[model samples]
Target: MPKRIMEGKVVSNACDKTVTVLVERRVTDPLYKKVVRRSAKYAAHDPQNICQLGDQVEIQECPRVSKRKSWVVISGGTGKPSEKRIRAGQDAAVEAVDTGKIQPKKAKKADEETVAEKTDDKK
Candidate 1:
């Protein structure tokens, strides 16, 4: 029998040598007869750790490598975000900070000052 192969997007790569791929498929609802999207996450073995988040990868069924990982990454890098796109996102975030559109966390010194004021008020 032929092994099952699937294509999905890598949603997480936090585990060492493992990636979580999210596979989405459209199925027709029996009662409503409308098409609906269904998705499932599969833990795939990534020996090389080449797969990155948001990358489109092909996974193939294989003997279990771990408790939850039964699939292995066969191919990837087709849909990985480009360096320019990532840099653009970082630039946008910096611009937001510079323009005061996004407020960053307060410094520890400010927290200390607030704590001192509270103590003085109590006294």
Candidate 2:
């Protein structure tokens, strides 16, 4: 039998020589017949420790390297963050601002007075 190959995004690379890949697939619901996305996480071996978070990677089935790792990374080690990761970071920043965890820089006093005067003039 041929080894199974799958492409996914690396969600984590915190382990020494392993990265967690999140593989998503579309499946039709048996009862609703609606297509839904399903995802699974696989621990893949990365001997060189090159894979980074949000990196797209191809992993192939191989003999178990550890208790939960049976896939080996075959290709793809782009260090750039993916769009999803960037959006997540933006969301986190927004949340921090909303919760007062991060204070946004204040506008200059002159700028604030001008904006206030404009609003007053419109009234």
lDDT of 1 at 91: 100
Candidate 1, residue 56: how far the Cα is off, in Å: 0.3
Which candidate leads the pack in TM-score? Answer: 2
For residues 1-123, what per-residue lDDT tens digits would candidate 1 score against the true structure?
A: 899999888999999999999999999999999999999999999998888889878899999999999999998754565455568999999999999999867669888999999999999
Scored against the true structure, residue 35 in model 1 reaches a CA lDDT of 100
Q: List the residue pairs that clash in candidate 1.
A: none
Supply candidate 2's per-residue lDDT for 48: 95
User: How well is each residue in 32-62 modelled by candidate 2, as lDDT tens digits?
Assistant: 9999999999999999999999898889999
How does model 2 score by TM-score? Answer: 0.67
Q: What is the lDDT of residue 32 in candidate 1?
A: 100
**Superposed model 2: Cα runs more than 4 Å off:** 81-123
TM-score of each prediction: 0.63, 0.67
